[model samples]
Target chain A: MSRHVIGVLVENQPGVLNRVSGLFSRRGFNIDSISVGVTERSDVSRMTLTLDGDEKVLEQLTKHLNKLPDVIKVTHLDAGCVERGLALVKVDVSSPESRSEVMQVADVFRGAVIDVSRDTVTVEVTGTEDKIQAMLDLLREHGIKEVARTGVAAMARGPKYTGTE
Target chain B: MRNGCDVVLESFDAEGVDTVFGYPGGAIINLYDTLYDADLNHVLTRHEQAAAHAADGYARATGEVGVCLSTSGPGATNLVTGIATAHMDSVPILAVTGQVPTGMIGNDAFQEADVTGITMPITKHNYLVQDADELPGVMREAFFLANTGRPGPVVVDLPKDVQTAETDVEYPSVDDVKRGIRGYSPTYGGHPRQVKRAAEAISGADRPVVYAGGGVIASGASRELRRLAEITGAPVTTTLMGLGAFDERDPLSLGMLGMHGTKAANYAVTESDLLIAVGARFDDRVTGKLDAFAPNATVIHIDVDPAEISKNVEAHVPIVGDAGDVLGELNSTLEEMAVRDGSEWREKVKRWKREYPLDYEESDDVIKPQSVVEAINQHSPEDTVIATEVGQCQMWAAQFFDYTKPRSLVSSGGLGTMGYGFPAAIGAQVGRPGATVWDVAGDGSLQMNIQELATVALNDIPVKVAILNNGYLGMVRQWQELFFGERYSSTDLDQVPDFARVAESYGVKGVTVERPSEVEDAVREALEHDGPVVLDFRVAREENVFPMVPAGAAINEILEG
Candidate 1:
């Protein structure tokens, strides 16, 4: 099965997220990751969902998402789309050598050390999913404590917008 | 200035909703009180589920948005099955439910439930009116959403405070409400290119079959479907929900196609070179063993719901539009094309129909359920509304009846709810007061909502109920007997009440028919009754619906018993 990222524009109303997510679970479609936020229009919300399915599955998923009254439009963010994900990773750095190693690894990835404690260091990273995965892999050698990720947020690379008229 | 309840009534009036089916409870007392003196006709069903089913039946019969109302918590939850049934069949129904006050919504107040959360997946859309000002808009939107596009059930959960809270906001006009919903715009006309492609496919095929479904009825496309069939000389096979979409007496009609569908229809579909599916989804029941279904055919699917296209079975030419509009386009396009002569294919289908005619063994000792359906058909008018409870009785009604018009057969096709028929028949009778409405039910299915007999008796609804009393859940029993070596588990109804006596107890006319000879007379007597009547026919317990596909088997692999 191929991975697909679909961007949906929906009415910014109460329980609209529940309606969208409920449809996924009800129809037995699996969702890998989903990120939601208000768009340029305050009354509308944009949801970027990463799902694993084939062409037929993606088509079915998009059609079902469009059926929801809250959803305005659904777009498949394919080749010409820019996708990024934000992740916060806290690493165990009890020793000064380990702390410097973590700092160097974070510096190489262009990530910032957002918080530091006596035995732990939290790094804030924003990049493509692959880049974040690569940085996280390097930090894993230093004993990672926790990781919180805001799943991929995507948009078309060109001037054409998702919900634009 | 007006209260939220007044806005609700005004919205109904504006939408031309004359009837509502509901059950009263504490949370909805305010609305019920308002309905007490309103111009709207309110049908008080004995149970909330029956109310929903009746509304659904009304919607199916009249092509209008059926409305059902209920109180909070248990009352609202009771409407769940009916709502899901409507959702599955794409029936246009509006379910209005009362909620606990906004302040007590999350505190576990008495008679409180998350109505919106409960119905999220089952409804086309739903709303929890938190403010009084939102009531008018929500009511209008709920009706519009329920009735438009690929229609289904929509819920409006009104808080007690919202119902009582007053606001002077003017209720929006119908056009305004229709334009206000930005996210919901249903495609009405098929793409011209797709329609042309469909027409070309139809014209080029040597053997073609038109598979119709509930969408044809929903879009009022029966005439268009007939025109297309006549123009192309394609044999038409309908799903259970599409029973009345085309006149069954037509020479080209193949009746139904599916698990319990006719041999002729199944064979036609399996052998056809082109399958034109109009407003019908490739449901598991219809397309048994999906990979093996219509394998040789190039499918052209036209449906209002884009999601339904290529859902179960992939379509070669997918047209998204209302059934009537798409069929009209196809017919026009076909007029300009040289359609292939299908006389040889028609003769082949006719030979199949003759070779595998639907018939049941005649026994003077006991009643055959098929004969009961025939007896009803013989006595009823052409436009009679026949609703059936699920199981063998439902299949028998589908197979035996000669439906001549749309909106005549109102059976639960998608959800297959057992207790759907009686209440739905009541709703159909209410919708068409001058038509003869009959509920053909199995013993187990009829008992599920037999309580609705009180509602019918009270309202003096002249709905005739024919019970095929087999003393068991016959469909499951048939399965057990065939597939499980006669190990009849919990399928038998050991102590089914005498349905006729039960009807009599409800102050309605009742009759019990034991032998085959008594079927016609009982049906006539029931039909003659000016008010509601229940006729219980003790059908042979071991009889099973044949020409069966045995569930997962291909439709062509039918067993004729």
Candidate 2:
């Protein structure tokens, strides 16, 4: 019943993402959030997925994920891992006071004001999920008009990725 | 200049493919015409779906990449079930579908379907050829990917125009084609440390059992598996897909395990301390009551695919390599180690075998399904390749037959697809020139793809189809009798058209064996026939495949007949 994030390095091929997600659903594993992006190796892509399940099922899921042809490696990136998420939030600012309040909150959260209009302000925030969620909750007080979120992408922490690390 | 369709024919020759199971249509007319000039042999199946199953049977029987082809739209879509069956069971096959034309691909023109889009999920890889020049590479890649690693189905969607379009590009050599898939190298040898761990587990265990599956056959590891088992003196229990991978007559054999599995096999698996699973996936059916499967075993899973190691049941020593290669290495390690006394475990399993042996009532009027299978086992050659359609017939064939050689038994283990046997038997007979191939089918299931009888007759394949005619979808009927208040719904087949008559209509020999006394004689007659023959054994309508775990029930909670 707890959320766990897993980073998977897979071949950069068409429908590899679908295979990963399809394996999840077919095995009755519940996915919370999923994100994928090109890694340093253009031939390979990294998939960060969040799922809620018991440890046994999660272990089984990892094994199933590893079974796909395009999948190269899978690692649970919860500890000693640099995890981040991005969100673009538009806040309704009818009045100048509310707009200033929104900017003040964004500044405190280290979120940049990416776009500004007469009626609304859009903020770009990126950080660990906790940071993004806390900033979004604060922005909600100013009347959130829209929100778009990318799932967490993760990698091992620090300078080394060798077996010793 | 040679057209793209001729390139397809040349590519088949380049891959050493001698036979193709396919159905021709408008989109593939050019490819069919090209076949007439080429030396490639084609077994024209009655339906596209039969072509797919036949191809699967060919793969299972010959251990070669099976090939099937169909035209656009309905023809391509018809291969969905068969393709999925091959995919789920990891049978290597190349399914070529003809597209409407490059110009009309997405236009929804006559007989146009998104062949690639539809097969994307099922295939190991798929290609919708946008250019005729890429056809050679795509075709080669399809075969390479289909047969490599955890072998499964691959699709090549050639648009009609692409087949007709002239191509000057020469066909790629096998080496060049193998190079097409750069990232698809499969590990044939396991990590040395893991192999040692597995060997140590095998030597130290008092109750060791070898759980073999189709991967053994896929890797051609049956000889290695038998040697490994003999070295450790462990009883071997094969999964349904693993039938014929080991000698069933040997004292070390525990027969098939899981739902409808032998009591001794299931008990051995449940009680064993060390379960060495070779190329077995621990499927839901095999691991009934998954949590309780091999409850006390320290599983050592050896498979070619790394992903399968701990997917279902956790393996203490997960060795990823070809089954034959892994076992070969393990055998070397075990040879240096001391053998343990397994007489206690062997004796206990022997007692179980004696206590609850697979038995059925000998009836004079109605032919027992088990008895029919036994007669087939008794009469058929040791190398006979038996293909079964789904239902009581499949379970009975798996249980009763004495499979002594690899690739001697082929059935739909994963998808449990019905109507698979006749076409599969046809394919097996074609793949293995003179070997006896039998389609052990039920009345209900045989009717699903019965049209393939024409293919058998036309090809003069000499395949023997032993239809266990129970007049019901026997497995479903068993369920209905057990749980659904005995209401015989659509399960009642009523034997319309009569399978024997249907066989005769196809210009093949057909016989109806109603009495138990006729069973052996009918089987003999079928075997003696120079061409294709069908034996419809009218079995007990109420007969059920026993030792069922009752769906979610644990393997230990099986109800023995």
Candidate 3:
């Protein structure tokens, strides 16, 4: 099964998310990550959706969703399009030597130390899905206390938005 | 003399608008200015939401598209909920909203909240007039869209600039209206093969029960449903929305099913070998534990909405169509098959009804909601239209009101909005002037829109309002008592106003009933009143609607009081 990412452009309004999620829920489809935010146009908002489903079901779902009133347009982006996920990892910084070691790994991954205290250091990283996972793997050796990641907020590779006048 | 607002006002007049309900603001002031000089009358609703609902009620009662106007921003947003409610119930309403100027479209204009975008989900269709020239076409389309198809609310957002902009307006042709939309799709009904299949299933079954719902009323198929039940000798059970679809007094009627449904109704649904669900959505509230609901039954679901077919409980023989058309077809098919009454099925249903009956303790003091419903039936004309707000009173009205005719009773069946009845009653009264229209409401629900008393009085609509003032949101409190540790929270409503004074302020006669003896007189006085009247009956607050089966529980294990 090929993992696919789909970006949905919709008119931002109350119950639009509910409608989109409801479509998935009713079809018994498990969504991986969904992020909704305002687009360049104030009237419209773009929803970046990640889910696993049969290709035929996804195709049918996209058409059904377009049939809803508020849904303006939907686009299924290919792997060539650059998409990034943001993640923040907070790990224990108990040992003095490991702190530098974690910082070295963070520097390699282009991750920033967002917050630092004697017991813990919170690293913020933003990149494609694999890069974020790699940063987490390196930080895990230092015994991570907690992690909070914004669930897959995404956009297209170049100057292209699904919503237009 | 040649103002753009006048053009719009004249168009409304031509479209047959006798009355409109709305609260005017700065954006709509120009339209109101034109209305003031014109013969068109407008009722100043306290809230824009009420105006929308009032328009919805008016539409439902009259079968014409209801019209409401509100200013931009909050005024438009307030109308959203009511619009959604009307859409949910499939009532035709045309909402006119004022928006900021076309130039001030997206600059965060004051009193502007993108009403067209916000209402897209709620409305069947909406139009935002960017050009003044587009106003006539939009208005014409709004009316057509609302009144046609499944009948739902439509909105036309008139910018202040557009309302005040001078332009030559021409109404669009009907062909132009249907160009973009496929409005001619027929709602589902009986197909020949499915009707034959249903008849065969019914005849072959050992025990069969007819589970009817609100769609029966919408389809105007109550008599047909009853006929099918009688012919098959299958006892009838109704969901909360399905109450009046069956005659409550009929011997074969097992009363309401689901949570708060009668023991017999629930028992019949559970034990029946063949479950025939007509015009009913198997709501979780009705089905309880879906796996356990109608366990032994080979369900045959017949509904208008394709989505409702096999959405919840799977149907062995699914028929998506109008209830009237399908039931009529099924009857003909049954006649062809020469299907006779199954004596064993009839005997089982009768035994269930006799053993676990719809029972309520007779109290000589406090006024029972059941008694109030019955009294309304006896006092009012048979053709009188009764609209009930949600809660215990809604259930009681659905149970006790004898609706031998179609569309005689209006209710917030799908959404169950609390404050629906008062405005709906006003709309009903206006729609059917000679018919006695009564808004049967619980105190908590009535207070939500008791302000509509003013609309009633001002319009001289004279709709009788019966408030079963139990001093609590009876339905919720009933649940708390049954499910929770009986620790009633926000349900208890105390320090109520003198309702008589409230009614008097609105220039309507008010009657109060405390004792059971006063019930008859109060209802009688309310009925006889020349204008709008309020009968506030301070009935039992703690009286729970009985025969309630908690959700997910077996239908047979009902909580009877």
Candidate 4:
């Protein structure tokens, strides 16, 4: 199965998120990750869903999503679209050497040290999923403590937009 | 300034809704008070589930949006099964529910429930109205959503405060409501290219079968379906929900198809080279063993719901549009093509029909359920509407009834909810007062909603109920006998109350028939009665519906008795 990202525009109303997520669970469609936020129009909200499925499954998923009354539009983001995810990773730095090493790794990835305690440091990273995963892999030796991630957010590369009038 | 309850009634009037089935409760008391002076007819069902089912029945019979109302919490919860049944069958129904006061909504107030959340999966759309001004618009949108493309149930939950909250907002016109819901435009016409391809597929096939379903009836496309069948000279088979979409008495008709489907219909579908599916989803019940179903047939599926096009079985040419419009296009397109002659295929289907006709053994000691069905069909008027509780009785009704028009057969097809028929028959009788309405019920299924007998007797609905009393949950017993080594379990309902006496207790006429000879006469007498009547036929206890395709087996794997 190939991984795919779908962008959906829906009415900004109560229980709209439950409607979308409930549909996926009920239909037995596995959701890898999903992110929702306000769009350019206040009345419309945008949701980015990342999932793994073959062509037919993707088509069916889109069709099912389109059937929701609150959904304004659903578009599959292809390779031309830019996708990004944000992650905040906390790592234990037992020594000064380890702190420098972690700092070096974060520097290479252009991650900001958002917080620093006596024994640990929190690094804020934002990039494509692959970049964030690579940074996390390097931080594993530093004894990762906790990580919070914002699922993939995608937008078409060109002037094309999914918006309600 | 008008209250929200006034807006609800005005919206109903604007939508041309004449009847609503519901029971008044604390949260919904204000709406009931508003209804007191309204000209609309409100059927006071014994239970909330019965009210929902009755509304569903009204929708199925009249092809309009059926409406039901209930109070908060338990009242709304009780409508779950009925709503799910309508959802599964794509029946258009609007469920209006009253919630606790807005301030106490999430504070664990008395009779409070998150009804909108509970009904999200089962409804086409729903709204928890917060402001009284939105009441008028929500009502219009709710009714529109319920009856529109791929119709299903819609819920509008109004908090008790909202019902009494006064607002100056006027009920919107139909166009205003349409403009508000911009995301719900349904495709009514099939793509021209796909229609052409479907026509080509139909014309090129050597063996073809027209498989119609409830969508045909929903779209009022029976005439178009008949035209397509005649133009192609293909035999027509229907899903249980599709009964009456094509006249069963027609020479080209192959009764019902699927689990309890006729042998000839199953055989025809298995061998056909082309399967033209119109407004019918390839449900698991209809397509037993999906990988092996219609193995050789190139499928052309026409349905209004895009999700249903290739949901189960892949369609070679999928036409996403209303059945009537798509079928109309297909017929016109086929008229231009050089169609294949299906005379040989027709003859083969006819031979199958002749060789495997539905039959049951004659018994003198007890009545045969099939004979009871035949008696009802023979005695009832041609235009009689036959509703049925789910199980062997439902299948028998579908099998034996001579349905010549759409909406003549109203049974729970998808959800298979027992106790659906009795209340549904009341709704049908209310919807079509001039036509005879019969609920052919199983003993166990009838008892599920037997309390509706009070509804019938009180309303004076002239609905005739014929009970096939087998002293067991007959369908489950059949499965147990066939698949579970006859372990019986809880299926043998030996303590079933005498249905005739039950009807009499409700102030309705009741009759009990034990002999086969009495079946027809009892049905005639019940029809001749001016009020509601229940006829209980003590059918053979172990009678099993035959030509059954065991669950998960291929359709061709028929089990004949």
* Candidate 1 per-residue C-alpha lDDT over B420-484 given as tens digits, one digit per residue, 9 for 90 to 100: 99999999999999999999999999999999999999999999999999999999999999999
User: For model 3 chain A, where is the 10-residue window of minimal lDDT?
Assistant: A60-69
| TM-score of predicted chain B versus true chain B for each candidate | 0.99, 0.98, 0.90, 0.99
Score every model by TM-score: 0.99, 0.93, 0.77, 0.99
- DockQ preference between candidates 2 and 3, better one: 2
Off-target runs (Cα >4 Å) in candidate 1 are none
In the order shown, the candidates' Cα RMSDs to the true structure are 1.0, 2.8, 7.3, 1.0
Against the true structure, candidate 1 has what lDDT? Answer: 0.92
Regarding lDDT, does 3 or 4 come out ahead? 4
- Candidate 1's error at B257, in angstroms? 0.8
Q: How many angstroms is residue B291 displaced in model 2 relative to the true structure, after the best TM-score fit? A: 3.4
Classified by CAPRI criteria, candidate 4 counts as: high
True contacts kept of 4: 0.70
Residue A4 CA error for candidate 4 (Å)?
0.1
Which model, 2 or 4, shows the larger lDDT? Answer: 4
Distance from true location, Cα of A25 in model 4, Å: 0.6
lDDT of 3: 0.79
